[model samples]
Target chain A: MSELLHRRTVVKELLKKRGDMVVIGGLGAPAWDITAAGDHDNNFPLWGAMGAAAMIGLGLALAQPKRRVLVVTGDGEMLMALGALATIAVQKPKNLSIVVLDNEHYGETGMQRTHTGYGVDMAGMAKAAGFARTMNITAQKDVLRLRPLIDGMRGPLFAQVKIDAEKLPLVLPPREASYIKNRMRISILGPEAALHQ
Target chain B: MTTVSKAAKPAARAAARRPRVAAPRPAPAAPKPVMPAGTSHWAEQVHPMLVEAGIRQVGLVPDAGHSRLIQLCEADKSMRIVRLTTEEEGVALLAGAWLGGEKGVLLMQSSGVGNCINMLSLPVACSMPLLILVTMRGDHGEFNAAQVPMGDSTQAVLEAVGVLVKRADIAADVPEMVSSGLRLAFNTFRPVAILIGQRVSGAKDFRKLTQPAGDINE
Candidate 1:
């Protein structure tokens, strides 16, 4: 199976289990998968999301305080604003989970090597920057290992998932109409109420 | 004999009188004061200037040259010093801070400039303002060859990206230049660069505070 497919499956399952989570990605595979997932009640865009994913999650977390916020990030997207991790750490949001898909390259941009190739320790770096929990998962088996840790996570968590670089078939349509509908649904129903669906 | 006595008495009386005392001179007006000796870490002065200029967020990548400014920012609550893993990350943080209605500055060495070239697009694309305080590393008598290339390229690269660059050769120029750069950055909503010359921060031992505390606890 393709890495992208694995990622999409994992994300779908995670979202199915834990609803109302914010899945943010740049304009590429992750976004495509999110767009394929179709709209939840919330009308927010699932693809081509920019640097504000974690930040928006931060705002939501701060506003609700009791709700959980999951930010699905890409390696390229996360590199654009890595300092957001430090800011999140400082805030110490108890219900925030940041999952970075570390393909080691900007898959959207012709698969160029990012800093991850230079032995940049993203997990260690996050921990040193004050994240409460940091982990790295390379295989599908390890994804299950993270389930328990992510389940009982009390504070901000940073999980770097390493995946093989292989293209996957487009799972969702490009129009993003369904994602927009989900965003709208979530807005009207509220994060909590929307998650119950 | 009486006239002689009278003259002698008059002379005696005149001599007995004390000569008019010179009016006690008021202590000479204190000389105009001067800036105290050894009170001139450019970083120390720049820290307060940044605070006064409303730059509350400072993102730093540990560089020996920026030690003083980093320590100063760390000690200040009004200014939060976020230590970044890379110079580019620092730049991004500053950009985010700008978006959130807060002003930010990045302090790093010149070599780190290489790490920041690609990330520089964030400000240019978003129309967000950024203020970077870069320490010169390679040019003036630098022992590290790795720093020379970026040091040479720093100004041109930043200028190429539409960022206005200013050089502060002396310690005193830092405050005014930082203040002016910040104003211009906000007014134009563009990134600005203030490059600190090697001599300004290079020679100083900034690990310890120059001023001694009156009380240890305080």
Candidate 2:
């Protein structure tokens, strides 16, 4: 079996060529991962909200319709809102993708083991829920394959990206929710969005 | 007798008739659904106003209190209604929608309000527009004891989370309150809660909400 990839490295690879893609980072580590990938105006990182990243992705996917929407969240966070997998599939926004970093622990809450570590299958759930594309990535090479697939826009896609369970340095993104929101609005809708903020 | 194409009737009838699998049942003639007594139609009244105010997205968890509003959003071609498995998800959906230059509202019952305390922080933290239409439970002849505590404390709980609470107990007040809520949320960029009173949503008849899978003559 190939070695499990690092979360930051995996996120970096996925986000490297994300031009104009709207990236939604789930609370905690995934938010940090997006920042480590180089935070941009299009990045709307969740600082405190849990179990919301994917549905938020659904809303954005429905709203933008044209732009690619990516949601990066941890396994714990993903589990907290598993029904979203079904909801997203029903909405079937082809431009949206959910990349779950399966580190198998609640990294923010004292590293307690989560359901994924005990073999709860999120990718299987997504596939059963009718996601157009589903991936369970365990190696570095598989990460490369995703780049082209996401580019194809044959989504709504679900990827359970298995990564090392080791805790790493916290490379935090912007914490201010309003600031993160306004910048993302400006990026997506330009000056008109700023007036609302 | 009805506006919807008979969603709730068959289910309620299906629940009423029992042990139909064993016996050969006749073709059930569905009875005309009598709209609940004193039907406020508050939800029906507010649906157009929300559309008029440029609000389109609707995120909700299933509840009898929000049945009409949910149906209204579902039927509208311009509005996008998202059915949430839990109430807290609506908070994040609205936040995402607002950032994407769209407007939306959250519909929930009092019991679901407890599920949202943590996530509600996202809107308050961002100062984003969050408009919630809550149908209260545990008040005004509620049958379910479990819903009582959350219902009694819904306002205080919402206030503690920094939401501006506006309660409407009767049918007439709902439209104006909802409009004010939209103004507070969309114009002021603040979170406003329109707590629909128990009497308005007819919280007492909640047991008659959903029936079993099979059809019945009753």
Candidate 3:
């Protein structure tokens, strides 16, 4: 078995050179991971909506076809809405990339073993669903390879990056959903197109 | 010999037999003809309305009632039709569309509403403009008992999740109702649902299709 890479390090590396990319962090740890990397106006981290990160990425990708859209989610969150993989594959937006930070455990719910821990393959599911690109990263060196896929890959891509399930200090993003939403809209579409006046 | 007639409840049958006498109305001096004829296909009217309203992304889970509308949407070059595996994904998808400055809507049947309940929190919390078109089942002419519970609770369920619910029972009224719903949702940035009732969408009668094609024992 390969050594597990740290989730925060991988997220930071992915977003280090992220230029104008729209990022959707799935609920819980993935949300914290992206926030920990850096809080930006373009980052729309989920405070709730557990299984919706990738689907949200699909919508954003389709809506903003020119901008790269990344969904940084956990394995548990990915497992909850595995059907989204099929939905996204059918759409096939070139700008979309989903990275599941597989910690093997449901980190938020007292670290119980998730489907991924019991050998459910997230990347395999995406490949089966017809994603153009799929990656399984279990080593630190492979984390760097994922950066180009997030930045410039011609893909509706999916990557399951195996990370250590070690609990880390919370790095919370803005809890107000409206604020987060409008902030992202202003950043992407300017205030004129922002919702709720 | 026909089981379809037997399927209707006695009270409903009695109401259908009663003659409906509508009150007389005065004619307008000038009729502004923005709407199509009352007999126009509801989906036909709705498809253009959505396009005109600047709906750029359409997320849908296939339903028999909205099949024509889905086809129309798919054919529209300007709109991107996203086929969702389940209805809940559409809720999040529309939210993402709004975040990216594009308007989107979700089309699904009443049964899919149950799948969307948890995800509805995302839109409700963010106050994203979510427009949903739900084709009802189990209401007037339904043959399936399984679809009844969700159909009956669809409006109440949507309303409970802070979604403004509107029902169009008459086919002619669907276009206007949907137009108003579009305004209410986009303008106010609220989650709004337009429930196309079984009367408007037409209930499914499986008995007609299930009738013996020929003598099976032959």
Candidate 4:
């Protein structure tokens, strides 16, 4: 009902001063948003794999339990893989957090209305799926509140932040998937382990 | 002609003398080759093989043929098993695991292959090592017609997505195929799928399942 928060600003705040946190962006706009925040080796923004951001976060969380894992995705991408919510709940990775930038429309597909636009509740679904914590963040001020939870919250935390549906300029990540993967691998695992692939 | 006849007569006389000792009885029929009694499922054999390969994460959508392997992975303290709601999640999950410096495997059935088609691109494009162990459902005496299409198409579909496909038609060959597939995937940073043929992992017979417990003929 009120003015929606800007997606880029929200992403910038979430990823500000990110240290060793593994960030996965869902396909399309979320990928662009994370790239807009700042393209770092730690950031793996998907050029594709529409519904897989959360599951990737879950795997990273499980693999490196000490490092925080964050997934930022759009409402459409999240809807495509709702079952991943259940899977993440069962795994209960304490280091994992998922943030949905709910624009209520498929921003990439010409702004067609998605289920979120018709009143689907992403946070409620996550809560019901047994996330340790869930939130529906609609206010700009609340964006600041998510930083601490993402960094240290006893997680499997889920948050659905409603963003404006207005299309913004694209901030693209590396086009080569191999380059993206290897760069992150080198950053996290060092050249010795990341070499070859 | 006289010399040739004489040589033939001597050779025939020697053979008759050697065998006249009494016709040796035919050797007793060798027993049919059969697996040892109480042998465990091939998945049991493959579980340890996975551990040996340094597989730290396992993403799985449960299958009857993989039941033993899943149980083994769950019990092992060193391994982490994530149960997927659909087979496709494993694709992304394993990719993430590799990014975090861990080796992961995916376990699914043949029908689940369709669910993973689009997601397979993640590994292909990224050149991440992905090893998938598939238990076939619709081959070799398949009872459920619904599984046929995907089961038959599993190899072709995976191959089309740039995955190297292998098959294990006999239980004895399953562990070896899995080992080779793992090596091929991880060493080369390629996506590999090993199809566990229905012959090796028996197909689920719906008719037998629907029958009452006491009505089972076997």
Candidate 1 local Cα displacement, residue A87, angstroms: 9.5
Q: What lDDT tens digits, residue by residue, belong to model 2 across residues B1-218? A: 64534888788777878765777778785332224577647777799898998887898887887888888888998898888878888888888888788899999988899999988888899998899999889987788898899999999999999999999887678888999999988888888899988877664554454555353223
Docking class of 3: high
Model 4 regions lying over 4 Å from their true place:
B1-39
Once fitted onto the true fold, the runs of candidate 2 whose alpha carbons sit more than 4 angstroms away are: B1-40, B205-218
- Model 3 Cα lDDT, one tens digit per residue, A80-172: 899999999998899999999998999999999998888999899999999999999888888888878667758999999988998999999
TM-score of 4: 0.90
- Candidate 2, RMSD to the unseen true structure: 11.8
Q: Which tens-of-lDDT digit does each residue in B40-143 have in candidate 1? A: 66677778778887777777777877888888888898876666656776665564344334567888888788777766766665555788888888755566
Instruction: Name the lDDT value of residue B71 in candidate 4.
Output: 89
lDDT of each: 0.66, 0.86, 0.89, 0.90
Scored against the true structure, residue B149 in model 2 reaches a CA lDDT of 91
Compared with the true structure, what per-residue lDDT tens digits does model 4 show for residues B7-109?
5988877876887567789999543223456876777778888888899999999998888889889999989888899999999999999999889999999
What are the models' TM-scores?
A: 0.60, 0.86, 0.89, 0.90
Q: Best DockQ goes to which candidate? A: 3
Per-model i-RMS: 8.3, 1.0, 0.6, 0.7
Model 1, position B6: C-alpha lDDT score? 65
- Model 3 lDDT tens row, B84-188: 889999999999898888899899998999999989999999988899999998776688999899888898899998999998887778899999999999888
Compared to the true structure, candidate 1 yields what TM-score?
0.60
lDDT, residue A127, model 1: 95
Q: What lDDT does model 3 reach?
A: 0.89
Best by lDDT: 4
